[model samples]
Target: MSCVQTFADYGFRALGIGERALPKTDITLCEQVVLIGSGMFWNIYFALLALLLGFVAASLVAFARNSTRAILWRPAAIFIFILRGSPLFLQFFLIYETFVLLPKVGFDLNLGFVDITVETRWLTRAWLGALIVLFLNTTAYTAQIFYGALRSVPKGEIEAALAMGMTPNQINRRIIWPTMLRLAWPSYTNEAIFLFHATALVFFSSFPAWQQKGDALYYASYFADKTFNPFVPYPIIAVFFIAFTLLIILIFGFFQRRLNRHL
Candidate 1:
């Protein structure tokens, strides 16, 4: 097939928009490239969602871990330890099995004012269940980075804020928080890249790809399996991921610059 036609067919294969069946025989280079590139849609989706949502959870956990109160610190510390200590591969399996054991009909939520049904069957799918695992894992990992930065946020600066008659909330919001983020920016950037790379594990682990709509690595593996040629497919994925990671760094660098502007 011609290059354009090859792309036209497999370009959206990963999204299930075209090419219901992948190339079984005579897999061409264009097919591998296009299919694997298309699969990046899932990778970007998983990474973006996990990082954005995980940061909120991580920041809260970081604050809790840094808190002087044992009530808050202990639980945060324990949660971070459990997640950071365990392998993500095992976490995926454990979480998937736990979801499997839950009632397929889902659980009920009664808020007195309202009631909600939480679906559990969907948790077995990679899109949701693997996402939850990745989210929690990234939160725990990033929380430690933020907590360390929080600790190093210069007590003198905080005291200066207090001396200025600033309220605790004001100091935290206007001063401490920004400083913590500035200090943590480099590590935070690394965490974002790490989480993006980890998205490759989603299909490989407990969560099965519902309709062969897996991520970049998944399609790359599929092509490799069919062609019995790891060289083209694997390197294509490497190049894609490297380009994606560099873009991430550039975006994070923009934020890092903003954070350090006042310094």
Candidate 2:
């Protein structure tokens, strides 16, 4: 088939939207490129959602870790310790197996007006299960970065805010939080890059891709296994990841400039 036709056929195969069967025989360069490019959508999806949700959770955890109360800080510290201490690949396997062991019927919630049954079966799928792992892992990592930045916020600025008769809330909102973000952003940018690159791990994890809808690495592996030539397909994966990583840098760099614009 022509390249354009190949693209039309397999362009979105990774999403379960296109052809049911991947090109099994007589695979062409066009087929590999198009299918692999299509598979990148999952990597982007995992990274984008994880980073967005993880950022909010990390911010909250950072504040908790910074709190003087042991009740707040201790749990936060332990959470960060556990997540950061463990290997992500192991976390994926454990979480997936745990989810599998849960009762298939899932938990039922009772309210005066009605009852709701939350499903557990969905947790075995990569879309939701792998996502939860990524979210928690990044949250632990990013929370530490933010906590350090929070600690590094200049004491002089706090004193100035106090002298200005700013309330604690006002000081935090105006002086502390903004400065923490600013100080943390450079390192956070690195974390974001790492998280994006880490999305590739989802394919290898215990979370199963439904209907053969896998990520870029998944398709690359498929092509390599079929063709028995690692040189071609594996490099394609690297090239695609490198290009996407650069795009991530450009996007994050724009925000980095904005954060440091005053300096």
Candidate 3:
């Protein structure tokens, strides 16, 4: 079968889609390509979900860091510094260890007459654990970008908004937030691209792949080990990642235009 056909058969099979078992022996280059491509799906999922969720948290952090009160400002500033200053690789390792140490039975909460058990074991897995790490990591990076943008917002805009009798929250929502996003878009684009590439480190960190299911780099590493040929699979993954990175740029570029529409 062709690579595409094989992918059709085993695409999400990692997640139990079509095939139950991955091909073992006589693995052709086509199989490698198809399987690695399939694995990229998870990478894309993590990056997109983390970025989308991180944006809101980042905005909140950015605003808090810029607050006049020292209480809000200090904690937010510390969070941004700690996450941004340390390597993301270390963060992943630390978070995974922390998650693993949590009780496998999960945590329980009693609210009035209702009792809820919150699962903690799943946080040790790559899907949820690594995602939480990536989410917090990206939030820190994006918050710093947004904080800088918030500082650089033109003084006249604030003055104009205040003159119009806008409330502090109204001024921020209408005038401040939009401009901050616009100003930060380019740098934020770069952060997002790097963050996607960083997802490769997930499997290598404390999180296990569970079975053979893994992201592109995980599979590419497997092929490299089996064939003793980093030359083929690794480069193929690089090209795929570069193409994926370009797609991210294009998508963000469209938003950049939309954000700057009034300007």
**How large an RMSD does model 3 have?**
2.6
User: What is the TM-score of each predicted model, taking all chains together?
Assistant: 0.94, 0.94, 0.93
TM-score ranking, high to low: 2, 1, 3
The 0-to-1 C-alpha lDDT of every candidate, in the order given, reads 0.92, 0.92, 0.89
- Pairs that clash in candidate 1: none
- RMSD, each candidate, Å? 2.6, 2.4, 2.6
Model 1: weakest 10-residue lDDT segment is: 13-22
Q: Which stretches of candidate 1 lie over 4 Å from their true place?
A: 106-118
* Candidate 1 residue 56 C-alpha distance from true site, Å: 0.7
Model 3 residue 84 distance off true place after TM-score fit, in angstroms: 0.9
Question: Candidate 3, after superposition: displacement of residue 79 in Å?
Answer: 0.6
Candidate 2 vs candidate 3: the TM-score winner is 2
State the local distance difference test value for candidate 3: 0.89
State residue 22's C-alpha deviation in candidate 1, in Å. 0.7
Q: In lDDT terms, how accurate is model 2?
A: 0.92
